[model samples]
Target chain A: MTTYNLALIGFGGVNRALAELIRDEPQRFSSLGFELRVVAITDLAFGSLVQGDGIDLAAVLAMPRGSSFDGLPGGSSDPRNEEVIKNSPADIVVEATFTSPVDGEPAVSHVRWAIESGKHVVTTNKGPVALQGTSLSKLAAGNGVRFEYEGAVMSGTPVIRLAHKMLGGLELNAVQGILNGTSNYVLGRMEAGLRLDEAIAEAQNLGYAEADPTADIGGSDVRLKVAILANELLGATIHPSDVHTTGIQDITSDDVAQALANGLRWKLIGEARRESDGRIVASVQPIALEADHPLAGISGATNAVSFTTDLLGAVTVSGPGAGRVETAYALISDIIAVDDFVKGAVRA
Target chain B: MTTYNLALIGFGGVNRALAELIRDEPQRFSSLGFELRVVAITDLAFGSLVQGDGIDLAAVLAMPRGSSFDGLPGGSSDPRNEEVIKNSPADIVVEATFTSPVDGEPAVSHVRWAIESGKHVVTTNKGPVALQGTSLSKLAAGNGVRFEYEGAVMSGTPVIRLAHKMLGGLELNAVQGILNGTSNYVLGRMEAGLRLDEAIAEAQNLGYAEADPTADIGGSDVRLKVAILANELLGATIHPSDVHTTGIQDITSDDVAQALANGLRWKLIGEARRESDGRIVASVQPIALEADHPLAGISGATNAVSFTTDLLGAVTVSGPGAGRVETAYALISDIIAVDDFVKGAVRA
Candidate 1:
């Protein structure tokens, strides 16, 4: 079997989910000639751990949920002290660190290190791709490695591959869709008669929204996603601040009821269109969409992106926008893309 | 330039559209290192022509619509009554012939010859793939060539690639979608208060429906497309007869009107699901979709397919189901696939 040494940059919920999915489907990966070996794991709170060859995944699963592996077998000698960048023997790095759209430095640093060290990088952090895609792409190009982040935008949906690879020849006209699942879920709840705080509380209870939830409900997360898409689709260098932003925080229950009465639905939409002058005009705003519009029916935590192209016309992809297993699927899909690229099956 | 020596099986509407799309943008194909050389064209009504090296696409575009190339420069010296297949010199065969689902023998014969001669084959003929995908795939595999018909299903939409290639690793549970464009257009028109015949007449006038229109409104067309999708998605042989057939023909304007009044839309949906017994079950019928359903809002000639998989969860792709440019885009996408396969970039 082709064993790949994997490094976990952060042992977050998504990384743990990836471990579970791979564990559950051992036969499938074995059939594909893949033997995933978790050689190291690194996190700020948990510090870093590097086993000589690989750690026992089965034993890791038996540990208590949300518990760090500082005292487990093959655990690092010094807990809360070692730097991840200085120590790790992995060919595939899974970067699931916290993202800050204000400055995508942490994720960017890990990506740069992975590419420069001739290791493939698969990330769910939108910050790196949104802010440093061009430079990271250049770094990967220079090092003959891959930088894939299918999880960064639409969870498990094939949006990045559809835009960057499948529709390679066509010139994209516009990309518009619901990019923030938390805001969408909150708005859907509000439309269903819940207050904003009530909906956010419910989302947090379901683990779909963060404790703060400002980045998601405020549409800043969607702005960052749109920035990534715009750079990839329109070849534009757009920052999150460059986009005109709006949030669902102001969407009252009355507004939702009014939209329903008008045979419409309210959604926090992130749209980026290439204007006639070749400048990319983008925004994340709450729009009253007709019930018949594609985006209007996307309820709950689902995410959908509609792409308008010169050749293939309008193509929309929708799926789970965020979840541990779904995001892990995206990370795995990104890894598979890198594998295909390494095998010379897909062009980068 | 990677010049492909191509012979036209039929100089029909789709062939003309593809020629025009290629003529309009030479740079698009040029960037991909493909120079499509239409060396010969054959049609029963329009006769046959053979230009030894290649035909000038620009000069051919100057001819009147539907006019034959009888007196063009370096045209066929052979009589118009003779078959061009016996005299044509080309490495690839493009079969855009009229579909005859009852037999599919004509296109199958041409496809066989192309494969036997080590020539790549690209077609818009649904009959062949529905009736003989297994045989053709085997033949193409044996000959080390390609057999692609992306336009056989959803025009320009990347359904085949999504099913057969991109999501190859996942175990697909179901493939459901609005597959027929003509029926969809007619149903949309009926929902807008037109009678069935009136809507069909409008569709015919707009070049969306064929002269007979029974193949579309009768749901046979959708059955064939579903069979193609099922074969790819399930990796099991499915005949067109295996599909549980129903059509929009019995759906009156009253039904559409009532559905609209009830906040629903009538769509001729084709659904294929894997049974617990491991058998594939499929149906083509007019289903009343709720306003919140993704397929409910898909109006006109648009098509959308939702794939439920073991890994990626649910993903939907919606796009132009049928159009001259759109269908031509499907053909070009197939060409690129074949090119990649030939260049050892993709696994067959």
Candidate 2:
């Protein structure tokens, strides 16, 4: 059996979930000539350590949750060690570090190092891709490696490959979606007669909203995603600031009641339409969509992206926008694609 | 410039449309290292002829409308001549001859010869694929060649690939769609308060229905498409006769009006659902669907397929069910996929 050495940049939620999926479907990977060997792991809390060949995933999963690997063979005494980066026998690097939108330096540094080392990188962090997509793409091309971030867009929805590869032949006219799940969940709760603060509090209670929900409610997150999509889809060099954004933070219960009275629903829509002048106009704003419209029916935290093309028309894919397994599925899909590229099963 | 040695088995509507699409987009093929060269033509009315190197597509397009190539450079003196097959140099064979489902001998024979002669085959013929998909698949595999018929299903909607490839990881529970366009158009017209005969006549006049619409209205066409999908999707190994079919031929104006009054629309749906016994129950029948349903909104000559999967939830793709350029797009998409497969860009 063929084996691929893998490095985990962060032992976070999505990385742990991917480890679970790999554990569950060992035979599927084995049949495809894939044996994922986690050779190293790096995290701020746990530091970095290298296991010579690979760590046994089953033993890793058997460890108690939330506990550090203090008993592992490669356990380190220093919290800021970088032995994993210096000595791991890994061929692919999975970067699942935290996102800092103002300055995407941490994720950017890891991605740059991975590309420089000629290792394929699969990431779930949207910060680096949103900040420096074109440069990173060029770097990967020059290094003859892959930089995939499908999980950064719509988790597990196949949005990136759908637009980039499956419908590559056709010219895309527009891409519109209910992109922000946290804001959508809040809006849906408000529509069900709850006040704004109450809905947000309930979302936090349910673990759907972050303790600091400004990134989600302020539309910054959706704006970054739209920027990535626009750059890849329309070939436009658009920064996050270039997108016209209006968060659902301004929408009140009165507006929701008024929309309901007028047979409409309030949805935070992220739309990128190609203008006649060939420049793309992208916006993330709350729209009063009629009941018959497709976007209006997308309720709760579900994410849906509608791709309009010249030849194949409109195809809409909707699913869970974010979850442990769902986002991990997106990351795994990217890994599979990278594996296919390495195996010469698909083009770069 | 790279060139592809190609041959056409028939000069029908789809073949003409394929030629037109290739002529329109010379750059697409040229960039992909393919220069489509139609080296031979075979037709019952125009007889068989051989053009060893390539046919001038521009000159063929300049021919007068409604004029067959009766006296072209490749025209034969004998109507029964098969010189195109006997003498031409073709690397790709497109078999689009009219299908006789009752006796699938001729189409089967042509496909076997094309595979045995070491030429990649792409066909829009439903007879061979529906009746003998297993044998043909095995034969193509044994010969180390491709046998693709994307046009045999939903024309250009990518239903076959969506089922077989895109939703690969998910456990699909059901595959349902509005598979036929002619019956849909007729039913839609009847719902607009026209008699069956009047609606059928209008459909024929509008080019939505055929002059002899038995195959479409009788549901045989939909049965063939469903058979192909079920076999490929569920691994049912089902025959056409095993499918329970009920066409729109018996649905009268009264039934349509009654259905409309009850807030429903009539659609010819082809469905394959898994039973508790691990068997598949496949059927093509006229069903009353509410307007809120995704399939109900698909009207005119449009088709929509909804897949219920264990993962990824429900996804729908709607597009033109059948048209010259649209169906030709499916053929070209298959050709591109085959080209990629042959070049090791995609694995089977």
Candidate 3:
């Protein structure tokens, strides 16, 4: 059987969920004529693990926190993540580290190293992609590898893939979407007469928002998503900071009521459009959309993107934007796509 | 430049639109590392034209309706379609033949011949795929070729491709959608206080419904679509006639009003759900969807499909279900997909 070795650079909720899915679907990988083996894993908080062959996913899952790999040989409680990447026998690098859109640090360097070293890269880190997609894409292409980040924008919704593969031939003009789920959930609750702070609390209690949900609520997450879309769909080299952004913090019940009065719904939408002069303009703000507009109907924690193109008019794809299983599935899907690409290349 | 020869089986509105798209976008095809050359075209009404090198697309577009291929070398006004399929030096058989779901004849035979003759097939004909997709798929596989019908179910909306390629790994349990634009437009107008007859007439006036709209209004179109989805998604070998179909012709304005009064919208929904015993139960009927349902927001000629999967929850893709450019774009996309597959095989 064909085999692919993986180096997971983060062991957070999303990565752990991916391990669970892999364990549960043995037949799936085998039927696809391959087996996925995680040869190394690295996380800042939980330390690192490495094995030349493959790690026992079940053993790691059963271990106590902080000491999961203490007894295992070649495992360290604090190891440089780059060490795992530089020496691991892996064909794909699965990056799920914390994002820093300010400079796209750590993840950006990791992706460059992976691609330069002849490994395909799949990431959920939005910062690195939004900030460095153009450079990263060029790097990957030069090295004859793939740098896919489908989970970076809309979790597992296939937004970027649809734009690049399915609608690749069309000249896409604009993209409007609800990219941040926490903000949408809060706004949806606010529409039901809840105060913004109360809505935020409810969302936090429901695990839809983090304790410090600044990136999601302050519009930075949507900004990054819009930037990613601009770069991926419009072929624009835009950083997250390049987008003019507005948060949903000022959206009160009065605003929701007024929008409803005008037969509209308030949504935190991320928009990117190609200007007539071949420039991409991107922004993130709350817009009062008519009830019939595609994005207006998207409700709590659901992400949807509508692509306006010359040949196909408007095509929309919607699904869960972010969840453990959802994000993991995106990584899995990317791996599969990379596998197909590599197999095709080898055939050629 | 790499060149791919094409044989058009029907010169209908959709095929003409596809030709126009290919003609209009010279840079698109050239940049993709391939040039498409139409080697032959066969139409029941307008006759046939065959040239191993390339048929003159511009001349055919400028000619009179019935005499499009007249005065051309090796052109016949009453040529058999099979003759072109058998004799043409084509890499792809672009089939837009008239669909006969009763047995998926003619189109089924055409596809079988194309595959057996070692040529790829990209079809917009729904009959063959819905009635005999399993056997046709097997035949194509046996011949080491592709039999793609991305435009069959929802014009060029990427329904089948999304289900098969993008979401292939998920264990999808159910699929529900508004598959027919004619029926949906009529029901949408009926909900706005128009009589059923008036709605149908308005749709006809708008060119959204055929004069003899039996296939669309009678739920047969959606039946075929659901059967195709069942086969493609759930691996259920089912025929359109096996579905319990119900037409929107019987739904009066009063029924729509009642549904609206109950805070629901009337929709001609095609649903397919996999049973516990691995049986797929599919049907096409009018259902009143709750206001917040994913498919509830689709309006006018827009079509939407919601797939329920074990890993990703519900993923929905919606767009123009049937339009000249829309459907034509689907065929082009399928051609591109086939090209990628073929190139990969050559690499192997």
Candidate 4:
């Protein structure tokens, strides 16, 4: 049995949920033909801890909210993310930091450090993937490591990996998706006679929206996801700024009602297509789709991506766009990818 | 470069379309890091032809419908399917024969012969996969080969493989799909104010339904697919007769109008779910789905499968259920599976 040692970069919700799964479910990993052991952990609030063999996950998870890892072996009050990442005896680094949309800081550097140190990376952050995906991917490949971020685009819905692995050999002309769950849920509530502000409040109360809801509602978050999908899947060299973005802020309750009266649904759609002139155009905007449209039925906090291929026509996949455990599954998927690559490389 | 020699059984629409792709597109194969060569072809109408150096697909594809392979070198008037499948210098057998609803005859035999000969098999026929999948898979595994049937459920839509490869590690509880496109098309037409017969005629006119159309409209087609999906994905040892089957024939135009008025759509749904006591329940019925259901938005000839999982929620995938080029692409996908298996096994 192949056991992989992991360095968890952030003690956030996503990583915590993953640790819980690893501790609770041994059969899941055994079924996938591998075992996972957390060797190092770094956090902004909880501080840092490193155990070369394996860390006691239950103890760490049971710690109080404001407590630090000061009494633990090899523990420090400071995160020391870079030092822990570069020198940890871990085959893979699990990065689940905050998305710095501007420059994709910290997370990108964390990914780079792990890659440069020849450790594979699995991240749930959109920042590093959307902004620095190409160079980071090249760097990892050049170093015989894998840089995987399946959670960036649709948060464990398998959008990026689906296009990369499942839908191979087909000419994928375009990809359009309902990428954001907050906006989608808000739109659904708007159709049910709620105003934008009311819907947003409901979303926040339901834990779908963050305290700073500007990114989710303003389309910038989707912009980063679109940039990642375009660059990684469509072979386009694009930054987040390149996507022309507009959110559902303008689609009012009256607009939603009118569209519903006319058998249309308002949705925030992020799209990227290869044009005839050999340019890949990426955008995020609100569109009124008919009842039969692939993305129209995606209500509530569900997300979907419809790939327009030359052969398969419009193939769509819809699932949860956000959740701690759901997003954590993306990391598990990425680790599976890492395991496959390493096993294949052993023969190579 | 890896070149896989193929024996195409039943050079019908699907195999011919695959031949056309191999003839027209070289870049597609080059991109996948492999080359495909058809070394043997057997058709009930055109007889059998085997050339160890690879046959001219263009000439064979261009041949008239009534023509036999008699005039060509290494050709016979009789199909000689067993001999061609066994004796040909082919690494994989591509089976695209007519599906047998009752016994899964000739196609099952073809798959068996190919597997017993220590050759990988990729088939688009539902008969073999639905009826004899477990035994054939065991035989192939014991013989150090593979038996893949991605096209059997939903032609070229990637349903089986998507669940097999992409959704690994998740606990899949149930799988439900709009497996039969003809029934779906007919129901959609009925929703547009057409009678069942009229809607079926429209489907036939659009080439979505066959002349008989009994298997499609009577829910037998969905039963086989459900059996295959239940047996394959959910790890159930069940036959096609186990499914409680119903069709869209009883759904009248009035029913369609009533459902539409109430914000629902009639769909022929095939489902297999693991019950609490560990028994698998499979059914095919005309379900009046709310607009937000995962399989509701699938229109016309498009097919979809919604997998209920522990982590990802209801992950749904939709695409074209049937087409010449599309079903042919399923063969390509299965061949890729074969390639991956062979490469992996070499190291094992």
Candidate 5:
């Protein structure tokens, strides 16, 4: 039995939820033929905590918002993310830091440090994967470690792995997804006659949108995911900027009502398809979809990705796109993948 | 590079479509790091043909429906199903025989013979997998071979594989699905103001329903799939008859219209859930689902399975329920699994 020691790079909602799952459910990991032990945790707000033995996850999770991991065993108020990621005795590095769409920041560095340290990495951040996936993948391969990021796309709904592993032997032609929950919820509200600002405020109240809702509404979020999909699934080497992006910010109530009258529903669709000439064309735009379309009925904050394949036509998977435990489950599935790889390696 | 010699038990529309795929898409198999060669075939209509070398699939596929393989090399006018399955030099057997809801005869025997002969089996027949799945699985495992039947339910849509593989580490509590395309189509037609008989006749005209349409309308087809899901997914040892089934034959157009009036859609649903006491409860019934339900918007012959998981709330997969190339793709997917197993065994 292999018990993987993990170092969580961020103590945010997702990692905290992972700690919660470990603290709460014992059989969840053991039933999968392995166990997980968190030995190190580093966060910007809560600082760094490292115990060669397992950390008291429940206690750390119960810490108040302003509390820091100072004065405990090997604890410090400074978040030494680099030191903990590189030197910690961790077999797997769980990176749940915030997604920096611009530079693929410190999270990318954290991932690089862990891979360079010869540790398997599982991340829910979109920045590092969408921006520097190829390089990081090569580095992990050279170091004989895994770099998995299933949560980068549709939270815990299993989009990338479903396309890569399940859709094997079939030619996947294209993928269209409602990748963002906030924008989808806002559009559904618009269809229900709410104004754009009012819908955004409602989404904020529902904790679906950020304070600045620009990334969610302006298509940048979906663009990053499109880049990730194009690069990972379609083998495209283009950046996120290559995608022709147009979000739902300009879709008005009149447009929504007119679409409803014509038996259509306006949706912010992020689509990537390989053209006949082998060029991958990706875009994020608002389109009025027919009621019979696979994505038309994805209601509320739910997210869905529809894959167009040669054999099965349109296959869609829909689930919660973002949540604390949901995205944490993404990390868990990635670890499941990591365990599979580790077992295969042992067998080989 | 490995090439799998195949014995096609049924040269029906599905197997013939698979032959066409092998004949046309040469890159389809090669891209997946393997090759498929049909060396033997047995059909009730076209008789039996066996060639130690690769059989000319194009020639066999081009033959007329009434033509028998009497004059070809190693051809017989009679379908030597058991002989071909047990004695053919086939590394994998592709079974696409008729589904016998009654005792799972002939197909189950074919599967048993193949496994006993130490050959990997990939079947699209629901009989063996749904009815005698546990014993057949034990037989295959005892013989150190693979027995894959992804086509037994939601043909080529990847229901069983998706749930078992991608949703790992999450607690899947229940599965609710629109498993039968014919019944769902009839229900949709009823929703569009057609009577039950009229809807079934229209479905037959559209090639969605079989000629007799009794099993499709009487809920037996869905009962078989529910049994499969209950046993294979929820680990229940329940038979098809154990499921409390109620088909759409009793649902009137008035019921459909009333459902629509009350913001609902009537659908024939197959559901299997794990009770708190660890008992599996499975049923097939006509359900009026709200528009927001995951299985509600699955339109016109399309099938969907909504997996209720503990972490992600509900994850749903929707796609083609049945088709020639679609069901044929299920065989392809099974072959993919066979190759994986073969490679794993080789490594071991």
Candidate 6:
């Protein structure tokens, strides 16, 4: 069996969930003929740790909350992320740091360093991908490694893979979708007669929205997702800032009620389309859609993306947009993709 | 650039459409570092052609109706499909023959012949997959060749790829959706106040239903598709005859109107579920789904498959179920997959 060493750049919810999954599902990974072990973990709050052999995932998860990596046996305190990327015996680096849509900072540099160090990269951080995905893709290709970000847009929904693999040869013209689950859940509540603020409060209570929910409610999250889609699918270099975004924060309960009465429902839609001249136009806004529209029936916190293509008309895919376990699944899936790529290269 | 030689076992509407697409999109295929050439084409009615270099797809398309393959410069009149499979210099065989739900004759033997000859197989025929897919999969695995049937169910819609690739590690419990476009179209028309007979006639007029629409109307087509899904996805060895099927032919216009009045729509749903006791239950029947149901919104000749999974809840995929170009795209996509497999093997 092949063994892959992993370095996690952020010890956030997704990373912890992945640790738990790996600890719980050894048989699953073994059946696929691969063994994964974390060699290093770096986080802003929890600090960093590096071990040449492997870290005990279950033991790491059992550590008390707010404990630093130094507290673990045979570990050091707060090693720099760059040190882990440059020095760790890792085959893949997974970055799950908080996203920065404005500028793909630290995450972008971290991804680049990992690729340069000859390590495959898997990330849930949308910032780097939305802003510099195409560039990073080129860098990874240059280094003969993989840079996968399936969780960036729709958690573990697999929209990117669907477009790239399933719809491989089809020429897609447009992509319209509900990419933000928090905003979708809030809007669904507003349609059920709750005020916007009340809906937001409900979403926060259910852990669907962040404590500081501006990113989702302001449509910035979806803007970033659209930017990533445009860059990856349409071969267009687009930034989140390039999109004209309108958030759900300004949408009142009355607007939703009125739309419902008029045979439509308000949905926060993230859309990107290719113009006749091949220019890509992307936007994120609250739009009214008839009940029969592809994205209209997507309720609760589910995300859906519809790809309009020349040969196959329109194809839509919908699923859960986010969850700790769901996002963790994306990382695992990417790891498998990296393994496939490595195997293919070796076989080639 | 790599080159792939393809042989068509059935030169029906889908195969002809594929030839036309290849002729129209030469640059698209060439840009992907691949050149596809039709080396041989064998059909019972249209005779057979063999060109070791490459058949002129455009010239063949331009030929008169009912012309024999001998009319071409370097072709023979009616070489048997077996001869083509054994003697032709083909990397992949495209099988789009008529499907038989009862016993997968002809197509099953054709697929076996191709696989035994160490050739990759891509089929739009459902019969062999539903009946002998498990055996064929093992055979192909032994030969290190790909046996892809993306066009067998849902035309070119990408349901199988979505499950196999995207939901790579997820535990799927059930799949429910509209698998037959003809039944859906007929039901849609009946819901619009047309009698069952009238709706069937309309579907036939639009070429959505066959002259002998028994397979679609009686739900046998859906049964075959569900059988394929059960065997391929859930690892359940099920036959088409094992499914309990209920046809849409008995649903009257009055029934449709009543269902619509009750916020429901009549649809031909193909369902497969793995039981808690490790048994798999499959059925194809006319079911009245509520308006908000995931499968309810799919109208007309559209097909949708919603996979109920444990990790990400329900993931739904929808697209056009059948058409000349749509199914043709499936064949082309499968060809690419086969090429990837062959290339991977070579590299390995």
When summed lDDT is taken over every stretch of 10 residues in candidate 1 chain A, the lowest stretch is: A77-86
Per residue, candidate 1 scores C-alpha lDDT tens digits across B1-348 of 678777877776788888887778878888777878788877655456678787776776676656666676645434342245444677677888878787686888888878877778898889899999888989998999899988888877888887665564577988889998889889988877899999999999999899999989999999998888888777769889989999888998888899889978889989888988998888898999986665776767778898988876777888888776787777888888878887778842
DockQ, all candidates in order: 0.54, 0.31, 0.53, 0.59, 0.61, 0.51
Q: What do the candidate models score in CA lDDT, each in turn?
A: 0.81, 0.77, 0.87, 0.91, 0.92, 0.87
- Cα lDDT of model 1 by residue, A1-348, tens digit: 567788888777899888887667777567555668888877655556777588776777676654666776556534332245435678888989888787797888888878877888999999999989988988998888888888899887788887765675677889998998889889988987999999999999998898899998888999999998888878889888999998888889999999889878899999999999988999999999985576776767889998989877678888888878888887878777777776788742
Please give the TM-score that candidate 6 achieves against the real structure.
0.93
lDDT of 4 at B111: 94
Clashing residue pairs in candidate 3 (N, C-alpha, C atoms within 3 angstroms): A347-B347, A347-B348, A348-B347, A348-B348
- Clashing residue pairs in candidate 1 are none
Interface RMSD of 6: 3.3
lDDT of 6 by residue, A1-348 (tens): 899999989888999998888788977677766888888988887788888789988888887777888766546667588988878999999999988877788999999999999999999999999989998999999998999999998888888977987887788999999999999999989987899899999999999899999989999889999998888888788778899999988898888999988979899999999999999999999999986677887878889999999899899998888999889988988887887888773223
What would the TM-score be for candidate 1 when compared with the true structure?
Answer: 0.93
Instruction: List model 4 lDDT by residue over B71-153, tens digit each.
Output: 79999999999999999999999999999989899999999999899899999999988999999999998999989999998
For candidate 6, the per-residue lDDT at B246 reads 93
In model 5, which regions exceed 4 Å deviation?
Answer: A345-348, B345-348
lDDT tens digits, residues A1-348, model 2? 668788888877888887876777876466555777788777666655568677777777675655666666876634332345434677888888888787677888888888888888898888899889889989998999999998888877678776665664567888888888889899888988998888999999999899999888989999988988888787888888999999988899999988987978899988888998998999999999876455665667878787777766665656678887777777767777777788788842
Top-DockQ structure, candidate number: 5
True contacts kept of each: 0.51, 0.28, 0.59, 0.66, 0.76, 0.65
The sequence of per-residue lDDT tens digits that candidate 3 reaches over residues B269-293 is: 9999999998899999999988778
lDDT of 5 by residue, B171-268 (tens): 88899999999998888888878999999999999999989998988899999999998888888999899999998888988989998999899989
For model 3, how does the per-residue alpha-carbon lDDT over A1-348 read when each residue is reduced to its tens digit? 778999899888899988887777878777666788889888886678889789889988777666655457768887567878877888999999989978888999999889988999999889789888889989999999999899998998888887777786787899999999999999988888899999999999999999998888899889989999988888788778889999998888999988887879999999999888988899999999987787887888999999998887888999999998899989988887788777774223
For candidate 5 chain A, the 10 contiguous residues with the lowest summed lDDT are A339-348
* Candidate 1 CAPRI level: medium
Chain B, per-candidate TM-score:
0.90, 0.92, 0.96, 0.98, 0.97, 0.96
lDDT of 2 at B341: 74
